[model samples]
Target: MRGRDRFALPILRRARRDATLTRPAVSILLPVRDEGRFLGETLASLSAQTYADFEAIVVDDGSRDASAAIAEAHARDDSRFRVVRAQRAGMVAALERGRAEAEGAFIARMDGDDVALPGRLETQLEALESEGLTACGGRIAYFPRRLVGDGGRRYERWINGLVTPEAAALDVFVECPLPHPALVVRADALAAAGGYRDCGWPEDYDLVLGLWRRGARFRNVEEVVLRWREHPDRASRTDPVFAQGAFVSCKVDHLRRSLLVGWESVVVWGAGPVGKAFARELTKHGTAVAGFVDVDPRKIGRRLYGAPVVGVEAAARFACSFALGAVAREEGRQQVRDVAAAQGRREGVDFIAVA
Candidate 1:
């Protein structure tokens, strides 16, 4: 099966029949696979959106359970809702398909197991329209409090702190500053940036980086917009594509194309695992690691990956064009930033923070 044939025939026919309907202001691209247990709740949240001028394209990616049927039932009741049945295509393909069917000026993303707060659509739309941002996201709160872990709490706090555009841009390389499901983007900008791709890493991160590369401005509404669900079956937890190594590769690839361009060699701060791993990837990408800067007295003067590990004081001696703060700890990253600033090196120009 290919293209339209991969979709349920009746659904496609209905979609074509409704082509004359008024185009919605926003299109929600939701992909579902075996999410029957939580699909209903997710759909209900969409129904509760205060911004009513939107269409929901629920792509049922070959759900073996009642996921497709549940979506169909919702479509039957709400004219704004429609379901597209796909043949087990992965998340990226499903999102692409939804994008193809979307008829809105803005495209918002939602997951089958997540809940969007009532004001999510309206607030994000206003931010994009009023502020002229290409893409917008909002803070996320993980649901089912019992399932929330230490890592989840920390991520929530870090991401929520990125209320301003500058904060998001500053720490984008450190981690995906925007929560994927809470994101809304201008349709034209999303298209220009090349929709979504499965680049052997998390698709959401790849999309954000791609938009950034295209000079798209991003902002986060300073409010919680989505109640993100955390479960053992979440792709980030179960998929190899979301692993630590994959993310490192993704970051390095984008860095090479953007910030790392024209720079022959770069210095890495932090001689720990995070720094060493990033240095190794940079070397593989043909970017030389000039040296590693560390605060530990034991590590200073030692050699790593054939590059000298120097103390912060000796960091200025290296002739590297750029530096990467590759420390994992938040405090450590801040210290790296402080040191870089004290050395008269400007952030975003002289160095970038990464994990």
Candidate 2:
């Protein structure tokens, strides 16, 4: 593990109490902190799930507001709602607490500020059981569309396009391939992967990567099932741990551990900013960069970070067993992949597109 323990299962502090609880078909692990304004509406969405055989395990992670009271209000009328006081633990710990308190065969994720579309649970449960997937999520839409930025919209598109296990796996190196709040995962599969952990980056992304590395089958429902609320205080946008550098560090660490092991050198395709940045991260993780490959006449002969920039043909001749295509544009990535394929480079085995 590069940062905190990867998939380290924590001992649930409330397991003894949870054992006597009624078991539901699905457990929604929702961790809320200072989300009083949105907690009630979020709870209502869960309460309205067409599949009624589900329980919402809401963990209050030391909220300074009425979030707990809001959750309590819902629990009073809905037997499916249970609130766990997590004092001051962060989101990852709170999620672990929620999982410990969960008594269902499947686990679903939700945020205090998000809304689940109608039939979200029923659709996911059916897909899970019918397709025999270890975990599955659905397409997501950012609410108050005007609040969403260009980057967020692009990310939403890229993530939702990964609708199969292979697609998700292929893009796992680039970024989190599934929407965390829209996922329904098999309980046993989750346990087998050691549940969630404080991985110093995005905890949801770390869990998804862990599960994918464990060979978990993943898929996404074609329809939108989650209304992802966007705001200035959103974790990803404000949390230092979810910063761009943290994500890049986490990805490089995982790739070094799982995929780049035993590889001495790699040819970076695309000498642009994205490619050079990824190359630097990979180097910091002890992987040697053979050089950069690019088609630009201006860059082909230059040296970046002490590595020579070569044309596509020269890159194919480099003394490296693997290559990482870090181009950001779709057309550029396709061109890079075509060049690699022409050179007999294989995806997953010999190369991967990181952009």
Best by lDDT: 1
Local accuracy by lDDT, each model: 0.88, 0.83
After superposing candidate 1, which stretches have Cα over 4 Å from the reference? 1-20
List TM-scores for all candidates, in order. Answer: 0.93, 0.91
Which residues of candidate 2, in runs, are more than 4 Å off? Answer: 1-22
Backbone clashes in candidate 1 total 0
Tens-place lDDT digits, model 2, residues 1-355: 3212211222221121232365777889999999998888899898877677677899999999999999998888887788998888798899999999888999999999999997797777767766778899999999889999888898889888988888888878788888999989989988987898787888887878788778788988888999999988888788888887788877787788677878888888889888888888978877888899888999988998889998876875775657898888667877888888888888888899886
Task: Give the Cα-based TM-score of candidate 1 against the true structure.
Answer: 0.93
Question: Could you give the C-alpha RMSD of every candidate to the true structure, in order shown?
Answer: 7.1, 7.2
